[model samples]
Target: MYNGEKRRSSYLMLFIKNRIGTVLIFSVMPLILVSGIILYQFKASHYEKIHAHLGTLVKKHKQNIDSFLNEKLGDIHFIAEIYSFHELGNETFLKEKLETLQQAYGPVFVDLGVVNSHGVQVAYAGPFKLGKAVYSDADWFKEAMKREYVISDVFLGLRGLPHFIVAVRKSVNGDQWVLRATIDFAAFNDLVENIRIGETGFAFILNKEGDFQTKPLMDVIPEKGPYMDLLESDTKEEVQIVEKEDELSGNNIYVSAFLKNGDWLLVYQQKASDAFSAFTKALRVSVIIIILGSIGTIALAFVRFKNMAHHMEKAEHERRLMNEQIIETGKLAVVGELAAGVAHEINNPVAIMVEEAGWIEDLLEEEEFKESENIAEFRRALKQINTQGKRCKEITQKLLSFARKTDSKIQEVQINELIEEIITLSAQRAKFSNVTIGCQLQDGLPVIQGAHTELQQVLLNLINNALDAMEKGGGTIDIKTRLNKDHIVVEIADNGPGIASANLKRIFEPFFTTKPVGKGTGLGLSICYGIMKRLGGDIEVQSVIDKGTIFRINIPLKKYIGEKQDLIM
Candidate 1:
């Protein structure tokens, strides 16, 4: 029973070694590889597409912001170019012009002022009441004088409201004068406040120094705002996407575009999770599909293994029964051949008996024979007849012994001794075929447990086939035996024309053979294969074309005692 468990374990190992790799390669690996590829492709393309679309949106908004600031600067430049400082000192004309300008382009401008070269506000209109305010050390005044035009960021103005100045400097008669307009900060904020991205998305404007130019839409900004470094750095790219973290949102996605005209940045930001909701959903679906596919593959492999194992078990049982029948048939064939030899052997004794009888009759018929001499001759003849009869009886007994059948009786058998017995039986055929038979039997080999009669039949069939293979070109047959691990191995090798590679795999199948039609029945190797399996052993064949063939038989040294007892019962 322990040996049976070991055999089962070996079979399981063999099955796993053969089938698991195939299952992983054909069924599992492809699914995993394909799923991974799909997920990777989706992630790369989807995010790329999202960033591209966001960049487009940022570009459009950037153009709007740039155009808005450019128009304000153009307004100040147009006034400076059209009106002289002397004319702009006329408050009536300037007030009318400013009112008309405000009515034309919405209420964006808070007021307009003309600053003389002396840095004093010479003329002012609307809102702030700085009639003649000193212009001097203001940053906007200084920048306008240096750059000819300037657009300032949001700051607290004279009106105590957030507003920015768009100013332009003109040289009139070699004297510098500035035309300045203060625009309402609410108008600048309105440009981006109404623009929406997702539920959490908003836009803001930042100056070149990373300071807020417009009122921020969010109340709290994260410590490390997205694109803050880019705004401060010397990066040349005008537009890009930035990933960062926010105080309110864990991860944020920001698309930023730089405005060259105002030296400001337009940033559109949203929560990454919210922005990529569709991609997240798709990823979830793909992960689920991969998991389900993995489970399904494992289940399918398991089912196939179970079905194959069951079928193999059933086939083995059927093969054993069929092998017993083939063994009986082979035994009958051997017995028929032996019958001829036995008849020839018995005929010699019968001829001797007939000769003795004839001699006794002739002595009786002779006239010169006395009573004593006749009696002596008759006794001698009778004795010779008895001896011949005994000889005939011995021959019949040998024939009967050869024909005896024992059904699956298990016993400890010396493998070498068993091979010698089969050799004796096939010696006559081997001689007739001019084949030389030899043995390399290992001494003190382990005894194998199996049915001796069935094993003998297996050997006889193999030896006869070997002899037949070498019949035309007489060759040597080498039978070798050895102890291999826990099994006894027998190798029957013949120097005959070897089997072709294409036909080698089919040799153990029923009705498959390489012999001529009338010369052989193709059941020999198939029967041998089945019988070896029934004996809890295996047979394998190897052949090289034009060289020879070797049939290896491996039989376990120990058989399951319970199984043997069950077979006997």
Candidate 2:
């Protein structure tokens, strides 16, 4: 068993050593490598597309906010350029102008005020009571004086609501005044809120100081939001896309654009999972396809290997069977030569002995010894000599007959009668071994066309094997013959310590034996199998350990024409 396993291992190694296995490995490896590359490339391209898309959205919102603020600044410049200070001071005209501005653009501005170069509110229209107020130290006033125009961040003003100031500085007659307007923070909030990024995405504006310029569109403030540091950094890029982990949302993607005029950052943020949903879905599909393709390739390779292994094993089995047959045939040839030689040498002597015995008997029967006292003993001895001599001659003739090879002669023979003859020959051996033999030949069994001597040899071999199996236990041997369809089945079964299941397949292999040394030669069943196969028959055995064994011989009713012609030709 260990040797068999070692041989199998060696065969497997040999198979792997061949180019077929190498080809399989190379093929699969390249497919795996190509798949990996494709997936990586797809992932990179997906993220790039998402980044570009997000960047475009952020830029769009930035333009919208800038356009809104620039429009309001344009309104302030138009009012300052068209109207004089004294005309601006006319409460009714200023109120009319404010109403016209509000009616033209939607109520983005709460009120319009004119502050003198002294930083004092000289005249004002609408909500606040800053008419003729004292000189101011306000940041918007100072920035307006320095930069000619200024837009302030959102703050709680005199009205106690979030609002921002848009101021434009004007000088007439060498006297400077500021045209300042307060825009509704809610209007700015609406603009930012309307720009959507994804399902959870929104836009927010951060002041130059990274402070919220309006109420944030999302739940989290700029200070605590993911990508807060990027928002605060002085990045030179106009638009940037960032990915970060949010404390509340796990992962988030942020797109930020800097507004140069307002020194503000416009940020569009969404959950990473939401923003990359399409990318992730496509990735999953690609991975599944790759996995399925790999499985298919591997399954195909496995099937190919399995088929090749089966063929290789079958070829090896046939080669072994052919070698065994050759050895068995050589043994039979040597045995036949020795048998013919011995029979030829012994036949002449046996014939002469028989003649001499007849002559002695003839002399004894003459009158010379008729009255002898020992005549009866002499006659009996002569009779014994003649009988034994003839027996020797018969034995020699049988040996010569067995040694001679005859052409396969097909004839119609009754299988039942043939089995009866075999049983009779084995009766003495069965009785001597204390084994019971039973025959169950079906009545009116159909005749079969086969070589008589070959069929007889096959049945005789099976009976002998059955008797040998029961020699120790003295069990029962049952020989049965029956006809089924177009074939005749002969089953010889024995209730003895049966052949082991593991050894059953090799029972017909040449030189395989279970008997002790010198008790038996192992070629009987193998020879029987070869003869049956040549005569277009099949031999099969079933066995169970410690129970019994059955050998079934199947022969067709009519000899196979192809096999018969092959044998004769």
Candidate 3:
């Protein structure tokens, strides 16, 4: 039994799995798979585009910076080669040169000075009073004496402001003199800071030793951004990209390139999410589409599955109806066989007994019994035997006729006679169950047009139910037939343990029963309800707890149907 149940369950589960599972596998799964594939490819391509664009920007800005530094250095070199020490040593002459350079390049040339090989300012022109400022221990001065010309990192020299200069060394009469020009710090800082892209993108310059050549907008860590690494490396690659995570700013993209002959690194830093924000947005949209598509697919699948299940349920109901029809056909056949069996089994014996009783009567008429003391009693007994035998034959004929009424042929139904016939039919069961069947059928009741077999069935079912109701403790069942306003009415009432109000209203509903498991099928009253409705009649019930119940059926002579019901208090 368990194995059979398991097999049935597995088949049902397999059916269910195929319903929605196959839909999702074929529709939504492929959508998700394709979307994932496309998104992955887009991610790779977008990252490459972002890196390439940032790298190009960093490289181009680095070139501009290199050109700016070289241009300023070139200006100093031209001045040193054109003017001699004695000519440039004059403060008036040095001032005129600074004015000319500044006029040509805006305020980029802050000041001009000629420094000696010993790091002493010989002549200073433009801005700040530093006529004899000594710079023997200064890094720019020391580096300048070694190289032919030098571009310095930002420093707070004599002016105590962040500034750098381009300078060239000249030798005169075995004495070394340097021509130096200060470039505006703000202009150079603008040069790097202007390399902005998104909100968090900015640029700054870092010298070989990890010092800022220009002021960056935000405080930056050279180690975190790997500025120090790029600066210290001897890698000939001019431009390189790296990504790192920072404690304060999350992940950042770093693009670095060599600047000013590898003396400084032009590094651009930006938040990674901000740099690839476009790609992230696209990814979110893709995910949303996949989600919405999945929802739509599942919803459609559910609708389709529900439609299929509904059709299956409807088909099953139809199949059950067909099976019930078959069962009803079998029941009619069995009833017919029962009727035949009763006639064959009981009628012949009854006829034989009647014939034997007559033979005894003939024997009583003989001379031997002429002077019998119980002659009158014997005649009366034989008469009663003959009457009972005929009555038995009448009952057998009634049963046979009732059983043969299996067809649904419409005809004029005599309500009074039909009620009498059903009462007679139920008399035996009523006697057996100790139930008294009584009727107050009115005479000359107007006949109604209906199915005779069905009307008979309705009356028989009601009387039999009354018998069953009073089976346990015998009670009375009263059946009444009357005529009112061209309609014939029949009311069946029983005085057994009464039906509760809750059950009274539902007694006509199919599959509602108060009888024990094997005693009732619960379809009798329901069938009666349907029959009366088609016969242009109404059936109503009234019951009180612990009292009795009345089922009143009304039938009309007109060939129309209406649901008119009235409960008699």
Candidate 4:
């Protein structure tokens, strides 16, 4: 009979927890969540679309640059062949031929030179020395000799001007000779510098190894040397990568490309923020609408529930009691679900703040580094630290806010802050377990209106799972966040012992812990999933055994806070 009573109590608890009536109890909150989710989905979709669009544009631009260079090189090669046949190695003959050719192709072929088999300057048509200059040791000379005809990579030449070489090798009277022409690099730079496809959008180019091949910002000068030795080695013509902070925008950028030059990794890139500016503006407008709508919905819901309860006193009293208990249970479930993640999330900000503080102290002490070239760099580093530290604070605050309540509440929250915290805490955890953590946070994030507690719960669950999957050791967790059109995203990832392919589909099921008996309840993730779904957000996990795992959560920002009284009641 005692066992039977225990079973009955457990069934009742389960029923109360899962009953659809719970939705009614949390109707207004759910409505707000749904509205926020719609906004989030719209925003996410917009970002994907914008990124895709920018990627396509960059690729097309890269192709154009490649085509332009190839066409120009082809023309120069034909001109060089004509000169070779004409015996232009003779100074007098070369001078006369150049004068005639200049008139016909002045814009395209500004200067021509006849180089001997050893790549030494033999005859020149331009104002430069005809016999004194030597090109034997030059990359263009070496490359041309190796190939019948080759376009040299961009480099600063004898004129101290950025140029690329188009050279063709010819066997004249059983002697090898190189016919070469120089094309101004500035010509290509000017072609794409000011062209914009959207607001604040301007395109730039990068070499295959992700270095700026053309003039980037006013301050990003290429290092004094060969271009990282990468341009000449990379055979892939179709790869692109976003530029990290340098002299440009003081932030990272979205870069794309089409492999147009086999010998060059030419790609075009644009600022992602600029490309998605329109969508972000639209998202903000939507947030304002949702804020107003959420208030109205809440008021209507309060009035309806109040009236219905007043008319059905007994049922209302019982329902209210049951709801209070369920809410308490849900709150506990959320806490349990988020235990490991909260540890990691909070630990992150604490760690970063500590590191930044230490750096600040170090900067104050290091007068030499401060006075030298490191000054500007140190200042920038500090700025980034503060920026990132504040972000961490915001995330922790959000988590604390969420953990304090069972119902929804809107507040000004920064998504990057939350993600940063997760990154910090998870990184520490990963470090202890021989796992590394990575973060990719976006800049210039806007404040949002949403339930902080729910978001925190989502973050916590995802992070903790990553920690556990590593079993004994050797794993990595990556946490990142970005602004979609109208929503914010947080992604948690891990490289640990992964879930079996078969178990992957069942991981989210309630009470499905795969651990040994008495180790886990499996309700943690399910409850987290429910909270996110209720909040109009979502949590998804992907993993592979002996490999790793990744979890992504998408949530809407709270645009406004309605009257305090209508919250959770």
Model 1, span 1-569: residue lDDT tens: 34544786678667755786788788878887998898889888988988888888888888888888889889878888988888888888889879988998879887889898878999999877889987687778888888987888777756677788999999878999898998878887988886677787888888876778876677535337755675765666667788877665689888888885538888888888878878889888988987898778777876787678768866885686467546644654454345535655777778777677767767766666645645776767677777767666655543333333225677888889999988888888888898889999999997788878778878988888888888898888999998899888999999998777567656765546778874554667755765676677878777776688998899988784444321111
Q: 1-569, model 4: which lDDT tens digit per residue?
A: 34534764565545444542554447646666776788688778987776667667667766677777777667666766666645777778866766765566554555678888776787777766546488889987887778777777667778776777777888779888877776656666776775566544555555555556567533433442223333444435354445455454544454545344444444333455566677667777777876676666656655565555445554654576466545645664555346435734676767778686667857656766656766667676777777767665654544333333345665667777876765676666767777676777778888766667666666776777777777487666777778877667777777777777456555655546788865665656665765565555656665655567777776666443334331222
For candidate 1, what is the TM-score? 0.51
Return the top candidate by TM-score: 2
lDDT of 4: 0.63
Q: Which stretches of candidate 1 lie over 4 Å from their true place?
A: 1-22, 219-223, 233-236, 244-251, 313-569
lDDT of each: 0.77, 0.78, 0.81, 0.63
Cα lDDT tens digits, model 2, 340-452, are: 58768988887888788788888887897899999889888878988878766765554444444336687988999999898899999999999988989899988888888
Give per-model TM-scores: 0.51, 0.64, 0.64, 0.44
Q: Candidate 2's error at 427, in angstroms?
A: 13
Q: Which stretches of candidate 2 lie over 4 Å from their true place?
A: 1-52, 86-94, 128-135, 158-160, 172-174, 219-238, 241-253, 260-262, 271-273, 328-454, 463-569
lDDT of 2: 0.78
TM-score of candidate 2 versus the correct structure, residues matched by position: 0.64
- The candidate that wins on lDDT is 3
Candidates sorted by lDDT, descending order? 3, 2, 1, 4
Candidate 4 at residue 349, lDDT?
Answer: 63
Ten contiguous residues minimizing lDDT sum, candidate 1 = 560-569
RMSD values, in order shown: 17.1, 8.8, 11.8, 38.7
Compose the digit string of candidate 3's lDDT tens values, residues 130-165: 879998898888988999889999998888899997
